[model samples]
Target chain A: MAAAASSSDWPGRYHHIDQILDKPGPRTDPGFLAGDGVKDFLRGQAKILVIGAGGLGCEILANLALTGFKDIHVIDMDTIDISNLNRQFLFRQKDVGKPKATVAAEFIMKRVPGVTVTPYFGKIQDKDEEYYMQFNLVICGLDSVEARRWINATLVNMVDPEVPESLKPLIDGGTEGFKGQARVILPGITSCYECSLDMLNKQTQFPICTIANTPRLPEHCIEWASVLEWPRVFADKKLDNDDPDDIDWLYKTALNRAREFKIEGVTWSLTQGVVKNIIPAIASTNAIIAAACCNEAFKIATSSAAFLNNYFMLIGTDGVYSYTFEHEKRQECPVCGGEALDLAISPELTLEQLIETLTERQDIQIKKPSLSTPTKQLYLQAPPQLEQATRPNLEKKVSELVPPSGEVTVTASTLPFSLSLRIAYTS
Target chain B: MKKNEDAAAKKKPKTSAAQIRVQKDLTELDLPATMKTNFPDPADLLNFTLTITPDEGMYKGGAFTFSFAINTNYPHDPPKVKCTQTIYHPNVDLEGNVCLNILREDWKPVLNLNSVMVGLQYLFLEPNPDDPLNKEAALEMTKNRDQFLNNVKSTMRGGYFKSVQYDNVLAR
Candidate 1:
């Protein structure tokens, strides 16, 4: 607190900005990042949106405000909890159960005058496309991969190369205990979030046989409850974990199953953890990760320093190790790069099989997909009339649908980007 | 009486989305051999108790109990877990709020009660001094490892560790 007193004052506030201030005496050539007015550019009306108001979000907001940004918007659907006080520095005991976004914004506005932070106390999906377009940049401190992917897909879809202003750079940060990473995502120019599917590890899944016939771990029992018993008993009632009655039914049923198998140690809390897939988090990692993200944001906004090429990987375990490298763009990136996707399929495979295969692919996911060739509209997923017409295509062989090794366009209501598949029949 | 009965039948308790997920999750729980679960009432899925008798660690041969309360928004939100037994440990604070990540900020829709129990069990086996909810206990564990062990054993035997009284967790 004593050391921060120097920078805490208005007069000594911009002292840290000296490090990034460009040199006056230019030698030969200057780039976009070079020269004066860097300070003015940062202090300019550049609007930034920060996703998540948890550990990382709390630090990112304070960093952005201290880094000379004027207009900031934060969106989070969570309220403060008692455990958050350990790391979430901005909040107090009284603020528990309060909307994180609203409380965070009000705190910042009170602390840092001249900074107007509008907080959205809702999910990112709640807002329309137009609402996101207003921001100069979007910084995400989100914990979930699903939320990250949604935000990534939304940003990629929103990118129009023709409109320079529409190019929203999504700077993302994630922290788990001692490990964290920050990445700079240039929607159309550099690799988008969807470009690198390999970076995200496959979600752990147990075999259906293991979960059903022989359940060893608690996770297996939970999976059985989710995959089998839920549908068997509560077919009419869609399972929602938030509901106490639904949970109660599942718990009793699972307990009965566990008792029948003579398995020990099944609890209601255990069921919740298995279903939720919770991870570990700490304050130091959140602080370190958020700082990296804010640093990248400052560089990107003011061009004070060259922004992270693509990814900045960090590991705080054992010892702190960090490296920055440019992640290459995939030529056939579904979200960003629009081109024909090459697929190797068997001629004997039916449209149903191919649709199943495409849906399961790691890079691309399409639910209720439709296929069409140049000459014929092979299948359609929408409209009662069209679905009835395409019902025959499911049984039709792949070779019969189109030439053995030809191309077809795929369309789906859920997909943000359509695909043109160039198929090569193997058998 | 007839009118009241009709009103009761008409106003059925609306089931929540979280309850459905919780119901699904509860049927699949896999807990450890050392621990057992007890529900005060079979109808109440949200509140339950967990009893653990660790075979190994500083709190060895000691019994510990914890109470869990799941909110209506079970999967999306984490359940509140508290230690029923007062003990000297770095993770579990004096007020019974345990310092487990899954029980707090690390919580997600995919995590279940089983994972939380394992985590809590691990705390007894190898308490983390790095992230401490109790500063005094953390200092003892990190600064003086031997003294910390002694303090834990003494406290478990129904004595004071740092002038703060703890219940006898040892199996009598």
Candidate 2:
């Protein structure tokens, strides 16, 4: 394969890499460098994974493919739409109705020869740890904050203290129209996404009073339809936001409310936007952010340059501007930092009661929880055998099974990050 | 090679949230007679053209055309807009990349094509000399208001200002 790096088989596109093969990056471990030199290492074996083949994903795939990455995998659950034509630049109108990951992979494979592009047209959660562990690095072009948090925790959990070679670098990019940000996250090194969770503005939440009693804005009226009207009209049914009928019903109901209140500018788009909480995205912003993210990924992979210290914010409105600075990691971050949190709970509280109590708490919003002590499984919320074996424990006092004070690791899919709690029982 | 698929793609019947909203918005279209929108291809709802003739303002009696490209992900994402004409204006550039805040950062799902149209109309009635896309036009307006008005007149008359040639925009 090293011979292939020199022969006619070598991709002519990477002709400029000969100058940088001797240059070493900040990483010193010989194990981190593949086979022989940097060129052979980057062009021969580096495995890269891209999450979300939407706006940023398309650009990242192209950038990585042309940047000398050998093997790449893209995962996205979205389908191509007519609207993606302006900025995605990969998929043509003919590619509509196809999975984004599949189409993006196909498009890249055809355009960039010698590079293998694998596509996963499924949810990120569906992929297991073994799958992600194969990748040298992960680049996220995702739109959802929850999805990013899940990937961040998953990558952080994969970092083994004994194995320095097992470290996985995550480069994340996000955009809202003219504004965008890209950041480098070296798990247990730089600030993980959760470490900078507060940096994300708290998602806009409509007050119940404004939504119910005084519906002034179109958003307020939409909230009223979903939060109040849905329950009142269809007591037995759950409102499916994806359903056009459900949206139409909300639009009509909200518009009627708006008319009564003499509020202007109540439209179907606004109703849909309010219900789904859509963020305005721009193709240009996605392109800019993706380029920065891929630049960091390429630098991290080849050591061509130093990676971003931590974060870079790009603003494209009014000419253009960008700023880069390191965002510090929090010491108490549940995923990568500190020991189990110490919790004081009454010994008389049952396991089910504790679960209920945790659900009510904003910090630990696990509607269903499975708890285990340091040695044995104390209680599980699922599986017939485990549920039956732990059924009595749920009814019994917390002190009887978990003891007064010890560390317990809690697992739940709903949680943004995993929890390890030290139970300090009270009288 | 993908022509067959592309032709087939031109046949999808799915109506997205933006499409539904665009339909509703057009039916309720309350634009002044000076502005008009055209959909050359009924099958393709994402792209369209809007022509505006400013009845009054610095560029009054001049007709300007702008193109809008709305993504299926519309409402969540702002539409791609271009001036389509070469003009000397403080808000729109030579390449047609307009610098309207509503078309960029200030855009919301609540705002539609009508809102964008209104914004463009307002741009003519009173071109924002504060936040300008063409800085030269902005500077001219700030330093010498009469020269700026004369420059606008020249731009509409197919003349050159600051060495930037503009296409004649006045109605024949």
Candidate 3:
């Protein structure tokens, strides 16, 4: 097909996209200019990064390539699994165990002909700001909340008020079963993923006693097998969640427990789902969400149409319901909001207790947090020597450690930006 | 053989985050004079037993023992606390389940081992009848305080109350 196509055929291939760029409409972005420069910028110079290569990622990559995005880079650290073939359309049976990013990139570049897709088979964290800054925009098809928060914080922190190019617009898409959402985040301008942490459902947990002694539900029995029985039976060996043998053992154990309790409804699939915390994914849902994300990306890239205000939610489970609304930015958001977040805490709270509160807080959930003030380093979670030296600070009262100014800075392993907290001592 | 044994020993799991936090909490524990903590396995800080002997409550002269089991997600999650012995109390059921607010809905990561110890102590000091695990005890305490006290005294002294046997938790 590449040999049959001539250079003259390239312009005709993108004729539909050229029509939008060549003629401006009433609903176009305010800064959009009607000319060939928009198309030239999109096809010639624009560099976009697509994070993740599963489910929605394959669709997003295809949509971008078909919409005339030429230079694209994708990063994914996951390897191809047999289960991913149902929704991730880029790989075949022979491609199992290969990196998703590399396979997806190769597939896209081969089919699209004119587009170039570079793949990095590594974590998004491995790339520094220098790599991320080179891209004009980013599209995330990530399933992990932590990865989304990391990228959102990174883009938000990269924005320099003086440099316009440093502000990378992040378009994020997520799908769970028949429900999904796509949102446009102009870094330092719109509601980031961190600002909407409460929108996610809290993970459900079974009580220890119910699972240990009186399990009434199938899930309870499964938890008993995984949480209590697994450790006791295999004390030295860690249960590999991905290994089928381990899952089979857990399933057998849970089935026995359920039989003893006279409870029904324990199946192999349910056991795997419960153990792996699987969310049902449909290819149609991924396509719908990815198309929404790519539509926003095209608008942001070509200025052919007005981009989504902020958020678009689609619910296909209940007769194809959809809604678009602006998700407001939180002023106290730790990533992109004000100078400092006001935390009301008791004066007697210890530094360790404060770190724990930060870690468990719903809105600002940070893992492995380290704290410091202007005058001294209160505590550090890393570099064994420093952690050992600052270990005693964890026991001291917050009032004793904090200065009169009531300002403390916190850094976490999961976050790309430092959080400034202003302590408001509660009586 | 010595090198291989050393390697195997090193391969043993390092202290988890939950264990580290529990150790920190145990180290800084400021238990009152009436309370005592005993770790059956000193190396395993994740599981321990706490004995509370209130000095000046209605339940004075009674020693209540509770087993604390901290899981791997600690601080993020509250410890599993259960009464070691079933007794006649409003918040403690016959199956040894405790219904402390901090252990359930009101559990925040800011709460420490010390806070839980204090909360458990407060439970003995003031057994809240409003929220009860044992409804009969709650009803008895609410309807007739004198009879409730008698039932508690009898139950604490290793007697039968309402056809259920009770262990003698009285201080020796």
Candidate 4:
């Protein structure tokens, strides 16, 4: 442990962290005990699980390591791309095409000695509850909404009132084009990611007729080329948005279509951006958001100071504005509320229509959902034979399939936990 | 369990919200005698056809057939309407795509199949020269009305215009 090492060994190495952990001031947490043992615990015991190795992940990993967190694990399913070199400072030209988690782990551990970062080059879903239960806390820098929801549900489900250690603190950070947010979610104690699901912006979809016929904008032309022309031209193959050749073909096709319509502004970068749905990322935003997340993690782990209430949002586009507020836990939150969400529908609505409503609802977006009542299964999207058998039930009226209690359980491929819904038939 | 599943699969299919709404729309339809509808498959009300024969217009004697496919997202999303036969009109393209505002941008959940039928019929009665799927036809209509009417008559007779052959939609 670093406690046994004499302070003379490393003159200024532990000086900064020592000053904070060695003494308590006016704003220190009431539970804080100033001593060398706090530093030792941070250096030897605290285990962290970081959920991405992209822009914010790289910055968070570096900040966590420098903040005296010794044991760290990171999970990233993406490989390093040349485009990521602009903001993900941990990766270089030589590191392109390598697993992001592995390269990031190697870079951080090499830069800072005595810090061990274990990299998982796979999806976070691949790891089970037991794997997550071993960690002291988890920090997320993931950009995918589905992944964030899955992890949030998993962590919330792992909590047991009887066991204290099962309650893992989750620090999440995200950044996009000079705007970012950092929040702390204490599994069962505070508001979770699911509680604020409506905060996310809905995906923009161009109308099919607009893209197919009257395209007034460059994005509309790009959508036409990618959505309509690509499928018609390449019947057997799918467009790989990452490949330069595919993007070039789309750009040329869009450019030609734009010229036919006498429209302008069809560029290669715009084609790539439209196809990949790339958000503009800035390095400074990532660093700031990551540092905020790490600061929350540090305070939560050591209790040297009061942690952030729940959410902190920063908008740097107009002269650096920021705000911190407490996001209340929703009573109808499917994950932490422990109450079935109430949904009112017409009694004449068929099972298929009900399923469509569930899938389309922004707050309860579950892809390929299987539903079941207490006594009978309404529909199942899996296992060929079962799916075929339940397929007929899709056409049946929900009033006929569900019991008088109107309680149903929905499970989906995108979620880690089943959703409980209380259906009310509106006459 | 396997036998039970097979038996369940063989049972009668139930109606969906889209089917219910479509049935309601058909029952309440107030179409003129010049317009008619047909169901290719009686069991499937979601997919049907509408034929409109304008009474007094440039396309008076011509019968235009449009196929409508309504999915489960009906009312929220408009039905997929397409001309069954390619015709030369300002609003209808060479590929039979229609350019009706109600069918695309102005669609609302309150709008029903009857509304769409009326919109389609109105296109034949008065083809708007502003929003055109066929720019050449729209331009002809705007620049020289007589020449546009000639092109429409010739195209309806299964003749060629600008090296493009159109389907014979004229009534027998």
Cα error, residue A404 of model 1, in Å, equals: 35
lDDT of 2 by residue, A34-63 (tens): 324677767777889999999899999999
The 0-to-1 C-alpha lDDT of every candidate, in the order given, reads: 0.73, 0.74, 0.80, 0.81
Per-residue alpha-carbon lDDT of candidate 4 for residues B63-142, written as tens digits (9 for 90 to 100): 99999998755655678898988799888876677888778667765677889999999999999888777788988999
TM-score of chain A of each: 0.73, 0.77, 0.80, 0.79
- Candidate 4 chain A lDDT trough over 10 residues, lowest sum: A1-10
Which pairs of residues clash in candidate 3, taking residues 3 or more apart in a chain or in different chains? none
Fnat of candidates, each listed? 0.00, 0.00, 0.00, 0.02
List the candidates' TM-scores in order: 0.55, 0.58, 0.66, 0.64
**Candidate that would win on TM-score:** 3
Quote model 2's TM-score for chain B: 0.88
Query: Measured with DockQ on alpha carbons, how good is candidate 3?
Result: 0.06
DockQ of 1: 0.01
Error of 3 at A112 (Å): 0.4
Where does the lowest 10-residue lDDT sum fall in candidate 2 chain A? A27-36
Deviation from native of the Cα of residue B13 in model 1, angstroms? 37
Per-residue lDDT, model 4, residue A345, is 84
Clashing pairs in 4: none
Indicate the residue-level lDDT of B145 in model 3.
Answer: 97
| Backbone clashes, each candidate | 38, 2, 0, 0
Evaluate candidate 1 and give its CAPRI docking class based on DockQ. Answer: incorrect
For model 1, residues A1-427, the per-residue Cα lDDT tens digits are: 2223233346656776755565523321244444335555566557899999999999999999988787899999999977678888889999998999999999998999767789999999788567888998999999876577668767775654557887799999987668788999988788877666446643466644455556777666776787567875665787887666777776777777788777866788677656665456778899888999999888778765567888998898879899888998875454566444768787899998988998998787668676665445566653333456667989988888766435576756445435667666675
